[model samples]
Target: MKNSAVRLTFLGGVNEVGGNKILLEDFNYNVKILLDFGINIKDYNDQYDRNEVPNSIKELVKLGLLPEAEKLAIINLYTDYHVKKNQDSNDLETNLDGIFVSHPHKDHFFGLSFVNRNIPIYTGVFTKKIISAYYKCSKTSIINNYGGLNWKLFRTGDILDIKGLEIIPVHVDHSIPAAYGFIIKTSGGIVVYTGDFRMHGPLAAMTQDFLNEIKNTLKILHQQENKRGEIQKPRETKVKLLICEGTHIHKGAIESENNVEQNLEQLFTKHPFDFLLVKFDRLDWDRFRTFSSIAQKFRWKFIITEKDAYFYYLLNKDEIHESMKNPNIIADDHILILTQGTVKYRWQEKIRQAIYKEEKGHRLIKYNEIKELDSGFFFYITSLRKDVIEKLNPNFRGAFISSSVDPYTEEFIDNNRTLSRFFRKIGIPSYRVHASGHAMPHHLINFIQSVNPEYLIPVHSDQPHFFKTFFKNSKIKVMIPNKNDRFELKSGIVNGSGVF
Candidate 1:
C-alpha cells in the first residue's frame, strides 16, 4: 500500500520561550500525533487575573497561542503545574493517546496532572523516581492511581511501537539527569526531536552516541534508496524533518569548561573569607563536580544539603563516598547542611530520628569533625524559588557563589539585585560562577555542519532567525516554523510558507 504524506505543525515554542506543543498528522489518513503540550509561563503571568473567568485552550487559540485542534491523538506532556494552573479549562479537556515525558523538570514535565487520567505515560526509570518524589513532596495524589494510567518505562535504544508510529528514545545531555531526545518514525519519514541538550557535561559521550545514530540511520536510508528515481525508492533510513533547538543561537560562544573552572578557582583564591557560600542549580551535576573539586583543593569541607546529597548520590554515589573517605569530607555537621523544603523536610526528620535513637549514629558526623578555626567553603545548591531562599537565610553566610545561569532580562536583573541585597543584608558577598548548558552559536554551527541534515527547524528559542546566519553558505533548507504552521513531508520537499 502506498504511504501517506506526513505533516508537522507547531503550536508553541516556535518564536519564543515556553509553551512547546506540536502536532503531527498523516494527510492520507486520520492519524494525528502531538509532540509537546507546554504552557508559556511568562505569557500566563501577563494575562492572569484571578477574578476573571478561567481561560480555555480555545481561548488561547483566539490569542494566537495554540493551534486549532482537529483530531488529538498522542500528546507529549512537557510542562509544569505553574503553567497548567493557568491553562484555559478547555485545553485540559483534550483527550490524548499517551503522554511522553522528557524529564522531571518543571518546565518540561510538570503539567501532567492537567490531562485525563486514562492516558498512558512513557518515561524512563530515573524520571519515574523523580516524579514520584515530586508527587510525594507536593502531596498531590494525581499520580497515585497509576493503575488507571499506563506507565511505560523505556531506556535509550528502546523502540516503542504505538499504533503505526515508532518512537525510539535517545538519551541527551542536559542540566537534568533523565533528559532524552526522540526519533519518531512513520510511513512518511523519520523525524528527530531534540528536546534540550548541552555538550560540556558527563553526558557528552551520550550526545555523541545519539549523533552517531542519526548519521548512521540517515546513511543506511540513503544507501537503500535511489534519489534520482521518478518514483521515490524505499530507503532503509529516511529523515523527513529535523526538529532541533536553538536556545542559544543568538548568543556568542561563551567558553564554559575551562573558563568556568578558572573563574571558580580565582574567586576562591582571592577571597579571604572564613566561610564560602556557593549557590548553584542542584540538578547541574557538572557544576556540582566543579564546586566539589575547588572545595577539596582549598582544604575546605564540602558542605551540601541532605536533599542535594541525595541527588549527588543518584548521579555520583561512588564519587560522593570516595570524597567522604578524605578526613576533610564530612556528612553531618561538617559537610551536609539540611534544607527546610517540603522535599527535604521528610528526609531530614527521618535522619534526625535515626540520629536521636542512635540506630545509625555513626552515619552522622559530629560537630567536632568540623574545624571551626579553619577557612571553609559552603555550597548551597538550590533554585530561584523565594520560599527556598527565605528558609536558607539563617545559616548561609560569607562569600556567595552562583554556579547557574540567571535569566537575562532587566526585570530578572532587578529581582536578582533584590536577592543580592537580601544576601548582603545577611553579610554574604554574592557572585555568579556558572556555565550554560546549551551550545553556543559557533558550536551549534559546527554541529549542524557535522550532521548535515537536509532540513533543519529550530525551536525552543526566541531568536530563530539567527539560524540564517550560520547556514548562509549551505544549500540545506533552513526554515523557522511559527506557531500552528504545518510542513508536509513526502517528496523530499517541504510544503507551506510556515506560520508567521
Candidate 2:
C-alpha cells in the first residue's frame, strides 16, 4: 500500500532565530531530505568557541550537538572515522539523500563542515560559488572546509526531481545574493518553505516574483483538486503547509536598503571623518556596493582586506546581479586590495595572480604601510580585524560604522560590546547603520494571508508562539512545533492541533 502522508520532523530551528534543520520524509517514495542543516549558535557556544571545534562526528553526537541518529532512523550519514568509533552495528551506513541550502549565511550552511561528504548538497549557483570561494580562501579550514562534498547547483525556475518528489527553487530578496525559497511537491500535497526573505531590499522585485509564483501554484492546485472530484468549498485553501521565518515578529518598522545608504551618506556629510572604518558581513555584497559607491562620491580610496579581495575576484568572475556589480577590483583605480600578515595561504596566491594580471603596483597596499597614506580612505574591515585601526595615525579623525545584522546571540552581543569598548578606548566614535535581512512583521502578515495556507509552521524565530497572536482571527491553523516533534501531512491538512 502507498503511504498517503508526508512526515515532517523538526530537528532544529523551532523556538530560535538561527540554526535551522528540518527533515522531510516521503514514505511512499522512500525519499528523505533535510531542508537546511544549520548550527544552533547557543548550543555550539556552550560547548566550544572559535578556537575549538569538534574533532569527530562521534564527539558531536556524544555531546548532543548533531541530530540523534536513532531518532532520524536513516543510515550512512557519517564518515568511516565515526563508524569506527560507534558501538552500535547499525551506524555503518548512510541513507540521507541530499541537503538543500537556502543561502550562504554561516547559520544556514556552516554545519556542512560536519556532514558526510558522500551525500549531495544542493544550493543556488551563486550560493555554491560564494561558499566555495569562502572555504577556499579562509584560514579556518577546520571549521568550514567544503572541498570534497558533492555539490549540485540550481537556478530559479529549475525543477529538481529527486526520486518521485519535485522541488522548485525560487529567488528571494535577502542580505546576500542567490538566496531562495523552495516549492516542494510531495505525495501528500504541495508545500511551501519560505527561507529568510525581506521586502525592503534593492532586489525586492525578486521576492515579489516568488509571491506571484506561489499564487500561480495555488491556482494550479485548486484546478487539480476540482479534477479529482473532491467535494470542497470554493474558498478552500490550496496549499497544504507554509513554513515561514518570523525573525522580526514584534518589530513593525524596517530600515530599507536605500535608507541605509542615505543614512550613511548623510551622517558622513555632517561629521566628516578623516578615515572611515566600516565592518560588515563578508557575504553581504550589497553593503559592500553601497560603501563602494560612497567612495566614488567622496573620491576616497576604498581598501578591502585580502579575504574581501578574494571574494571580489570570485563574485566578479561570475554573472552576478546588476546592482552588485561596481568598482571592479581589476579595472577600477580607486579600489585597492590590502595585504596583511607575513603568512600567505594557498588562496592568497591565486588572488595575487589574478590581481597582478591586470595592474602592476598601485592596486595592492601593505597593512602596516597604510598609516603613511593620506586621510581620504575607506577601510573595509571585519570585526575580528579591528586592530587595523590602531595602526592608523592617531591624529587622523576616524569613525567606525557597523553595517551588519543586529545582535541576537550572547556571543554577538558580547562581541559588539567589546568592539564598542575598543573604539571608545581609542577615542573614535562608533555608529550603527544597518538593515535587517528578515521581513518586517507587517510584511510577514501580508505574505501569510496572500498564500492562505491551510497550516502555517513558524521556524527560525525567537518567539514562534507569537505567530498564534498574529493569526488569531484567521482561518489558517498555526502549528508551533517543539524540537524533535513529528508532524504528518495527509489529505491537504496537518495531523496536529494548534500548539498554543
Candidate 3:
C-alpha cells in the first residue's frame, strides 16, 4: 500500500464459461468498482430461486447465487409474492463507485437484481432496452423488479469519470447486441478488460477502433517467427494489467455470424421446410435479425415471441436499424407475435391498456392457429416444443435449426442429444449452425499480441491454461488466478495473494 497499486479480485469467472464477477479497488482513491456482476449460468435455470430469493437475499448468498460482498442490500417490494420492506438501505450508502455491465446476457447482468439501489450501474443504451425486455417477460425477475435503475447509460465512445477512475466503454461484437469492452484508467496505470468479444463479426471495425484508441496503452500487433527466428516488428503500449476472457481459448471449430447466416440460408434452401422452428438465446438480437432477413427472403411468415416483438420495437427507436423498422417484420403481418399461455403476461397486459386499439393484439397468433399454416412459416422459440410442432404439422417433416450456442460443452451436447431424440420422434431432423459469442483461439492470440500487456489474466473459460501456449512465443504473461484470489497491479508487477 506504500506505492500506488490497484487491488484486483476475481470472484466468480475464474475457470468457467460464465458467471463473471470482478472487483477492482484503488486504495489511493478508496474507490471500488465491480465489473459484470453475473451469476453461474449452469447453477440456476435462468430464473431466480423462487423459494430463497423471495424470502431474503441472505439466502441467495448462502446458496452461492449472490456473492457475499462486504456490504449488500435487498428489497422486497412485491407484497403478494414476498414480504414488503419498502425502505431498507444497509449497503446503499457504501463507498462503492459503481458497477459496469458489459452486456445484457444473464451471465453478465443477472446479479443486478441484488445490487444496492444507491450504487450506480454503467452500461450501453441498447443493453438497458434488452434488460427491460427481459424484466417485462419474466414474472420472477428479481433484479428488474427494482422498478428503475440508477444507470448512467452511455454510447460507445463516451468517456466516463467516476471518482478518479476514467472508464471508456468500447463497443464490441458479441452474439448479443450492445456489448462492450472497457478501457479503465486506474492510479496504477491502465486496465484493459475484454468483456466476451470477437473480431470476426460484422462489427470488427469497432474492435479495431477500440484498439487504435487504446494504442498508447496497448501495442496493436504481434510478430511471429519462422524456423529462422526472424524478429517481426517492434511493439509499444502502456497497459499494466489485461483481464481478458478466454471462453474459446482451446482448440475448436469457430464460425463467424456471417458464416452462420450463409450456412443457414443454404440449410433452409436445401430442405423444403414447411415450418422451421429456430431456437436461440432470447437476448441475441443479431441472431434475430439474421432469421428475420431469412424469413423475408424466403417469403415465409416470421413469428417471434411477444417478448422479442417488444424488444425489437424498442431497439428500433434507439438503433434505427432497418430490420427493426421493417413493417413486414414488426407490423404483425409477415412477422407475428406469439406469447406463452392463453392470457398475456404482465407486460403484455400493460400494453393492452394503451389507448391504441389496432396495436392491442395485432397478429397475436395462437399456438393452436399454427396448424392452419401449411408451409412457408418460420417460428423463433427459446426451446423447441414437440407439442407446438405437432399442432402445426402432424406429419412435421421440416428441419429444426439451432443457431444459438454450438454443442461444444458437455451440457450442450447432452441437451442437444435429448432434443434430437424429440425431433426424431416427430420425423424432424435437428441441425446446429451456430457462431460462438466468444473469441476464437487465433483471435485470442491476436488480442494478447496486440495488447502486449505486462500480464494476461484469463477468465470465463474451462481451459485457462490453454492461453499459456498461445502467449509462449511472446512476452505476454498468462496467469490464471484462482477463484476469490486477489492480484495486485503495482510497479508493472502482478503479484498474487490469497484475497482482499
Candidate 4:
C-alpha cells in the first residue's frame, strides 16, 4: 500500500456548466477513478456548423471544451453511463477500468459507447433495466457489439471494493428513477458526490435516507477510531471532501415548494384555453406523474406518443398491471399522440400498403385501430425545443412550462431582441414552473450542515463564489477548483493549486 495522499483533477465542468469529468488518483494504491465523462451541449452546438462534423479529439480540444489530448490519455476514461449520440467517437475513447453510472439520463450516461468494450459498467438495478430498454429500442450497434458487454447491477446500499477503493452508490431523488450519489472511500478520506438531486415529492424520503446513511457511516468510523490505542492518532470520521453541484447558484434563492405548487395550480385554473401544452423536461418523471394525476382528477385525457408510452410501460409495467385489476382505473382515457414526421410517414405508408392489398382482392381487410382526435385541451409536456414545436400548426394553442435553467447570458438578453420576438411568433409560452434538480444555496447550506464535510469543492456550475456566501464563518474551507487543478488530501486537510 502507498501513502495517504490522493490527487484530484477537474478536466471540465469547473467554471462552466456541463462536460463533468474528474480524475481521482490514489497514490497509496496507484489506482485512478474517473467520475463523469460528459460533453457540453452548448459547446458542441457552438463548434459544429449546421452540416459540419468534428472528426477528432483535437478538434474538440481546439474548441476549448475538452482537455489536452496528452493529459486525457494519462488515465482511463469512464462516463457516468449516458450515450445520447449514435456515433461511438462522439465521447472520449480510452481503456476504461469501469463505469459507475448514476442513472440513465442522456447527458449523464449516454457516452458509454466511447469506452473500450472490455471495461465493466456498474449501475443500480432499475437503472440497468432502463438502459437495456433504451439500447434495445434505439438498436445501437455499438451496444450490441462487445459480446453483450459486462454489466454489474448492484443494489443501492451495497459497498464494493474496487481496486482498493470502497465505492458506495447512494440513491438520490431526481427526475429519473434509480438516480444515485456516490460515496467514495479512499486512504485520504470519504468523498460524497451528488449526481443530481432535488428535495420534493417522492424523493424527499430517499434524500433523508441518504443523509441518515452518511451520518451513520461517519459515526461507525468514529467508533472504530475511538477503540484504537491512545498513542495511535484518531482517524477522521467526517468526509474529507464534498463534491457538490452548483448548477443554480447564480439564480440565488428559488421559490418555495408550496409557492411553486400554488403557482402551477393557479396557472392551470386561469389558463382555461382549448389546449394546455405543458412543456417540461421529459426525464422529469416525478413532474410527469404529478401532471398525470392532475389530469386524471380533472377528467382530462392524458396524451403521449407510442414510443414514450412504451418506455413508460417498461418503466412501470408492474404498476400498470396492478392498476389493470382495478375497475375504477381510467386507462382508456390516455391517448397516444403522434407527429407527422418520420414515424407518421412510415405508419401512413404501411397503412397505404395494407389498403392497396385489400383493393387487390387478396382476402385482406383494412382496419383502423387508432382513434381520431377532434379537439380538446392538450398539454404538450416537454423540454423547450423549437423544431419539435414547429411540426405542430397554429391551430393548437400551447404554452411552454420551462422546468430547466435558462442558459441566457447578459449580452444575449440585452442585444438579441429578435430571438424573443421570433419565439413569440412561434406560439410557445416560456414560463418557469418547476424546481431545479441541483440544490440551491440554502439547500446547499443545509446539506453542508447535515454532512459536515471537512472541505467542500463545488462543481457542475459557473458560480462557485456563491458557496463562500453560505460558508463565510465556518471553519470548513470552501474550495473553488479550476480546470486541471490537483488537490492533495490527507487527514482532512486539502491543499491544492490550479494547473493553469
Which number leads on TM-score?
A: 2
Per-residue lDDT of model 4, residues 1-500, tens digit only: 22488888887678877667777777776666667655566566667653455554445557665555356455434222333433332234454456677766654554454454445677888777776655544333432222244677787779977777888888887656677888888789888877766665456678777778788778877886687642267755788888877777666555444455567668777674444556444445655665565565555655554344445545554442332222211133443344334434433444334334435222111112112333444444433335544544456566545443234321011212233344567655556666655666666678877888888888878888888777879967788888888888865567798531
Give the TM-score of each candidate: 0.75, 0.92, 0.85, 0.77
Poorly placed runs, candidate 1 (over 4 Å): 1-3, 27-31, 44-95, 139-149, 223-238, 257-259, 302-334, 339-348, 351-375, 379-397, 405-418, 424-427, 497-500
TM-score of 3: 0.85
Tally clashing residue pairs in candidate 1.
Answer: 9
Query: Which segments of candidate 3 are over 4 A away from where they belong?
Result: 45-54, 71-91, 140-146, 216-237, 319-329, 339-346, 350-362, 384-387, 406-414, 498-500
Angstrom error of the Cα, residue 173, model 1: value is 1.6
lDDT of 3 by residue, 195-278 (tens): 888777777777787777677433321222222343344434357878898888885476777887899788777786678778
**lDDT per model, in order?**
0.60, 0.79, 0.70, 0.60
lDDT of 3 at 73: 25
Please provide, for model 2 over 1-500, each residue's C-alpha lDDT reduced to its tens digit, 9 standing for 90 to 100. 23578999887788887788889998877889999887777777779866776776778777766787667886767544232222222224468888999998767776787676677898998888878887767554446556566798999989898997889889999888889999888888778998889998899999999989888776876777777766466655367889998888778555887898999789768776888888777777788888888888888988888777877877787765555457567777788888876536777787877878876457888977878879889887666565677678877998888776656641222355667778888787888888988899999999998988888999889887778998989988998988888888876557753353
Residue 486 accuracy (lDDT) in model 4: 83
Q: Compute the lDDT of residue 75 as modeled in candidate 1.
A: 44
Candidate 4 lDDT score relative to the true structure: 0.60
